[model samples]
Target chain A: MNAVSRALTDGWVITKRNLIKIKRVPEVLIFVLISPIMFVLLFAFVFGGAINPGDGVSYKEFLIGGIFAQTVVFGATFTGAGLAEDMQKGIIDRFRSLPMSPAAVLVGRTTSDVVYNVLSLIIMALTGLLVGWRIRDGALDALAGFGLLLLFAYAISWVMAWVGLLVPSVEVINNASFIVIMPLTFVSNAFVPIQSFDGVLRTIVEWNPVSALTQAARDLFGNLPPGETVSDAWSLQHPALYTLLWVVGILLVFVPLSVRQYRLASSK
Target chain B: MAVAGNDGDEGVDELTEMISATGLVKRYKNVEALRGLDLSVPEGKVLALLGPNGAGKTTAVRILATLIKPDEGTAVVAGRDVLNDAEGVRRSIGLSGQYAAVDEHLTGFENLEMVGRLYGLGGVASKARARELLERFDLSDAGDRPSKTYSGGMRRRLDLAGALVAAPPVLILDEPTTGLDPRSRQQMWEVIRELVGAGSTLLLTTQYLEEADKLADDIVVIDHGRQIARGTADELKSQTGGERIEVVLVDDGDRDAAVAVLGQVATGEVQSGDSERALTAAVTGGADSLSQVLAGFAAGGIAVLDIGLRRPTLDDVFLSLTGHATESDTDSDAGSAGGEGA
Candidate 1:
């Protein structure tokens, strides 16, 4: 095999190794799996009737798009945590000593994490369905929604992988990702509509990729979220286009950047 | 001790020089682990880097393997520059670090196979290589087990086997047998010797004098991050001067008097012994000096239980050159009791 295929093969081998860790010590994936499910239950049951906002949709169904967006953006933190821990454990040092391209490491790790995010999405969606979440769109639209979330999460994993590589320790990873993810999630339309907030907060959310993703998913799931504050672009009319834009944009900015960081880090 | 640079030898064996490092220096924060270190390995030869802890042997290996860059210097493995052609260097050299390099999550078979694959072996070739290594390393029985469950020696062997999976001409090992039991250590020594026999040049750092004596065709001794001595085993011993004059005293009472007598006869200071048993020391010349040493002890009325003249050991060479023990017992009660009491 050539360089790229060899790298990808190495990546898959590494990815399988990590997945085995998650399999044996499954507690690693538990937080990622359970938190979203709990949020689905809490928002759909505990506070759904009280908010009683319009659109005649059950709070459970309405919250699906918003929480799916929240779950994946939140999952970015683990990407940093995993890479940092691997480095601290000297596993990354072993990888550095190998002949494989350094970029393969971050790519493999990010791809594996996206697979976990996809699993988390499935668990969250199933839990949402069990509690009466109904999709009003076609199977294709639902599949597209799932694809969008995974792509966004995968892109974010690259950015966080860079953070993990740069950070000195995994302890810093745990602390920094939370500090970064919390504000990014809250300021977006994950918990509330972007229009409900005014002034600069509204401006930030209107342009926020998180909001764009959530609004896009909501439209695809037929949850019927509000629209058109950011631009007159086609994505403003279709959530699919908006989600695609954020996914593509994140890939463009972070993937190469993370790969570059991985290269520099291994050499040092 | 001062060091002189290594001059190129007359005979040329390009395949034997699996690794060559010149003026290699590695810095960690404010500390220099390697200071202008130079090394050469003839094809199908094992070179042992002998030093105590913190002697920069590991740092040298890291630089040669391209796992870490040097502060200033150059290393080449299979003629690939460690700085300019790092990937090429990596492709040709396999490194077994101070720690076990196995992936804990992967089975032994998977770990070896993955490393093999990383070296560009295709599915069938990599798998075949992994299986061959597993059997060669005597790990076939444990190949399916997670490496975490393998014993320390087993893990170390597996790690070394992983390094060889790529069939690299150069192998850099940092303290490969540091923690293994005596039996395992011997086994690893044999494995390394066999590798050299098969045309793989190996540069290994180790604390075990016997390992160096047994395996290394060339020996380089480092202390405080400098190459204090470098030569073949016999050459090093010969450079240390004559054969050792060792005596075992019949009683503890004669120890001091024997020291005084030998102090007069030998060029070096007499090494003292503990209170309980015997006095042993190394000095030059065999039979002629042996009689002189015995006559001196007898004149001093120091009873001699046993006396013998033997060839100088690596330890003798080390002490004759550096005046320090290879395995310094800093934790001996005689040295540390006061501190512990305080």
Candidate 2:
């Protein structure tokens, strides 16, 4: 087989290995499913009453899109943690010594983690519906919104994959990704409106890829309040296009970077 | 004498070297893990790389397995250069590291099957190969169970089975039996022996002299990333002299008398043991030397608390060659320590 086909076949095999871990360790799935549900309810009940997104969109409706974006972005860290754990466990040595394509492990890892993001998205959507959130847009648009969230998160998985290979241990990757991801998700429009922020924080939110991700999801889900105008910032005004650009840009940068790192990542 | 006319047949009868490496040098930032190490394994023969922790055994093995590149060296395994044709080397060799590299969450069968598939075996063939290996390694009953539930020995067997998934021509096992209980170690040795009996060229790294003695056709002793000695197990043992006679006196005051008694039968230098009451001496005659020493002790009026004849261990071999006990060296490079089993 050619290199691309070989990578795909090898990657599919590795992806199967990773997916089996989820089946055997249901606790991981439970935690993955539970966190998004908890985020949905906590924001819908606690902040839902106190905060107004304005222009008559209910707080629950406004919150679900942000929650979906946040949950999937957090899900990307699982890719890093899994890779780090594999490095620590010495299983990567086995993979490295194999005749498979060099890109297979990272490809398989990031691909399998998409399953986590998808499952969490499903749980969050169910919780959103129960909490009085509705997809006001057409079915295809809502699907596109979910697709955008996954694509952006998938790109972020490559970034985390690089971090995972560089870090020495799983704990370090968890702590490192947390330090970076927490602010990336929180300082954006995921949990609050960009209108509430002022000055540099506002500009940061306007340009933050997380903000673009949330704004795109909100627009595609039709959760944006009727008659509410998006910010004039090019990123927010064309959030879908902006998020797509970040997705492509991140993949372009991190794919080669991560593959290089994987080649250099010795278990020792 | 009668075979003098058959000289030409001897050339054809010689085994091909399946694995050969020359002047392998690997350097970590501050520590040099391998310093001009050389290794060779003839077809269907086992060559054990023997050393203590941090002796660069793992580094040499890693280089041969194509898991890491040597700073300077030329290595060919199963007819493929490690640097220029790493994929070919990888394809021809199976590597089982010190740590059992099986995925803990995967079933024993799944782990082997996954490896087989990665080896380019199709789905049906991979499944069949996994089942066959599971039976061969005595893991059939546990085939469906997650490998995490396996004992240390079982996990090692599964890892070995994973290595054999492709039936590669050459196998590199680093510390295959380290950390295993004696029974498990013996079981692994038996499994390895079975593989060797089937005529697979094997290069294994180990710290246990007894293990090398039991399994390897030739043994290479290394220390601090350099080759210290290379010979068969018996040749290495003979280099340190013969059987050792260790005697512990009942009274510390008998130490002088004990030394004198031991020295009479000693072929080499008589050495004092850790305690003042004990002494050790290397001797030529295995049983006769013990009887002669007993007679000497009796005549000299030396009372012994404990006495025994023992074979020289890896420690003896290391001490004889390096002028230091194997474990006494504390300057293990970080690279080796990470790769060496505890």
Identify the leading candidate in terms of lDDT.
2
**Least well predicted 10-residue stretch by lDDT in candidate 2 chain A:** A168-177
Whole-model lDDT per candidate: 0.76, 0.89
Q: What is the lDDT of residue B63 in candidate 1?
A: 71
The TM-scores of all predictions, comma-separated, are 0.83, 0.92
| Residue range A132-162, candidate 1, lDDT tens digits | 8878889888888878888888888888998
Misplaced by over 4 Å in model 1 are: A1-3, A225-243, A266-268, B1-16, B234-278, B283-342
Candidate 1 C-alpha lDDT tens digits along B1-342: 011223445344244455777887766555566678888886678899987766777667767777667888777678678889888888887888767878887889989888877777877998999999999999999998888899989999998998898888888888888878989888988898888888788888887666787888889998756899998877787677646666778887777778777776665766654534455455655577779888897777877777777666656666878887665434322222211110
Candidate 1, position A110, lDDT: 84
Query: What DockQ was computed for model 1?
Result: 0.34
C-alpha RMSD values across all candidates: 6.8, 4.0
lDDT of 2 by residue, B1-342 (tens): 122225676655556779989999988776788899988888899999998888898888888888788899899899899999999999999999889999999999999999988999999999999999999999999999999999999999999988999999999999999999999999999999999999999999998989999999999999988999999998999988758899888998887777777888898788988978778898878889999999988888888899999888888898899888977455574456654433
Model 2 misplaced stretches (Cα beyond 4 Å): B1-14, B249-303, B338-342
Candidate DockQ values, in order, are 0.34, 0.69
